[model samples]
Target: MRSTPPPPQLQVVAVVGPTAAGKSDLGVELARRLGGEVVNADSMQLYRGMDIGTAKLAEDERGGVPHHLLDVWDVRETASVAEYQRAARVEIDRLLAAGRLPVLVGGSGLYVRAAVDRMEFPGTDPEVRAALEEELARGGSGPLHERLAAADPAAAAAILPSNGRRIVRALEVIAITGKPFTAQLPGSDEEQSVYRTLQIGVDVARPELDARITTRVDRMWEAGLPDEVRRLEQAGLREGRTASRALGYQQLLAAFSGAYDEETAREETVRTTRRFARRQDTWFRRDGRVHWLSGAAADRAQLPERAWELVRDALGR
Candidate 1:
């Protein structure tokens, strides 16, 4: 008798969308239904002690589904997309080898792409990076962002204006390769993917999304986001280049520094997050591979089932 061989390669499912678009809840629902696990792609959620502001789901909310790569980084460490890519691939591959489906979920567009897409990271020149850092330090992200927009409009549009670290990295890549940062990512050829993937984009109307973002900000403030930031501040959250600039955390840190009041910070969080969500949508929209679903538009209940159909069909393919 012949020995049994391993199963064929598994197709991964990615639930992606803007902030507060019900991606997490849907991801949990899908994972529970499909006997799969959740792999986080949210950049801000990677930091420890960032639950309230990042809106990280509580243990009870996980519905018994295992979530990987949540709270894996210290508050003092700058979040690295490259590092996250490596870790996420490892986790996704492990799940695949275990004969389980990997449900990739989050709003971080670049991190999501880095995990599933075949992209080459250009080498960084220390001097070039240091020079860009100096510029970012001296003038802030506005000037750098303008330059990036001139050099690579797509990259500038995708990255938030306040994300100095990512801006620097993009500029460094541009300087090193003398090419647009977006050029590093190849087209959506089937062979470019690490695995067969079903990219689902949760779509919501603008007015509803804006309202949801406002409500979320209010909830975060009510949940003692200030106190959480205070604790993380003591742990050097402000010192971390990446963590300090997270949406809610950035506003609160400014308030802490006497730049504004806590109320103003909360208001800014809502405003900026809505704008950031638009950028997130724009980023995912540029990826034609995403299958847009309106199940998140108005609390629609058919999202999970409809998504399952797509997943099921993709698996068969």
Candidate 2:
């Protein structure tokens, strides 16, 4: 009698896409269906007290799935993908060891790659970094960002011009490696997977996604996003480089500082978020490993089933 080989011992599922694409809800549904636990990859959602602005699901809304890595960082701490890679891998390993499926969910492309791909971060040079930081401090991020743009236009396009810290880091990397910052990224031919995984990207059309982003921003404002920022500010959010630059929080912080009124801040947040979503889509679409599922507004009702079908097909079940 011939017996079939056993299935792979570890299976990981990731639901990824732009913000306002219902990734969180689909993740919950996948976890429930697969008897899996959820691991959050959203960088902003890792900070405590950032619920409203980051659109983190409330406890009751989690549908009883155990989600790891949410609220893991204080708003005062800077986000580090290296640190996140270590922590997220630990959670994924734990889940796999327990014989439970792990569903990683978020739109943070780099974070997702750090978790599932064999990616290495470049070493930092204190002298070079300090010099860049000093330059940034004296002239602000604009000139340094211009330098980065000339050196690595793709990297610059991916990063927001207002992000001084990231701009400084990119320039530092360029100086250290004597290569474009994007060159350090995992190449299409060179990436290695750390797990046997299924990556499902939630796909939405541009016009529909733009409208959803606008509506989501409006809902955040009505959901007391300003109040949330006010509270986080008191907790030293402005001192945190990463937390202060989050989409809605940054705009609201500027408003609080009288740089702009609340209305202007809200409008700017919508505009910037729409731009950010496009960047996210660009990053994810370049990865051939992602199996995209329809996230169109018109296909809302069938999303979960369609996603599950993909999963089953992948597993050959």
Give the winner by lDDT: 2
lDDT of 2 by residue, 195-265 (tens): 87889999999999999999999999999999999999999999998999999999999999999999999
Q: Could you tell me every candidate's TM-score relative to the true structure?
A: 0.95, 0.95
lDDT to native, each model: 0.90, 0.92
Off by over 4 Å in 1: 1-10, 297-299
What would the per-residue lDDT of candidate 1 be over residues 1-317, giving only the tens digit for each residue? 99998555446899999999999999999899889999999998999999999999999999999999999999999787889999999999999878789999999987898999887688779999999999998999999999999999988987888888889999999999999998997677678888778899999989989998999999998999999999999999989988998989999999999999999999999999999999888888877899999855544688888888888787665
Q: Which portions of model 2 miss their true places by more than 4 Å?
A: 1-10, 189-191
RMSD of each: 1.9, 2.4
How many collisions between residues are there in candidate 1? Answer: 0
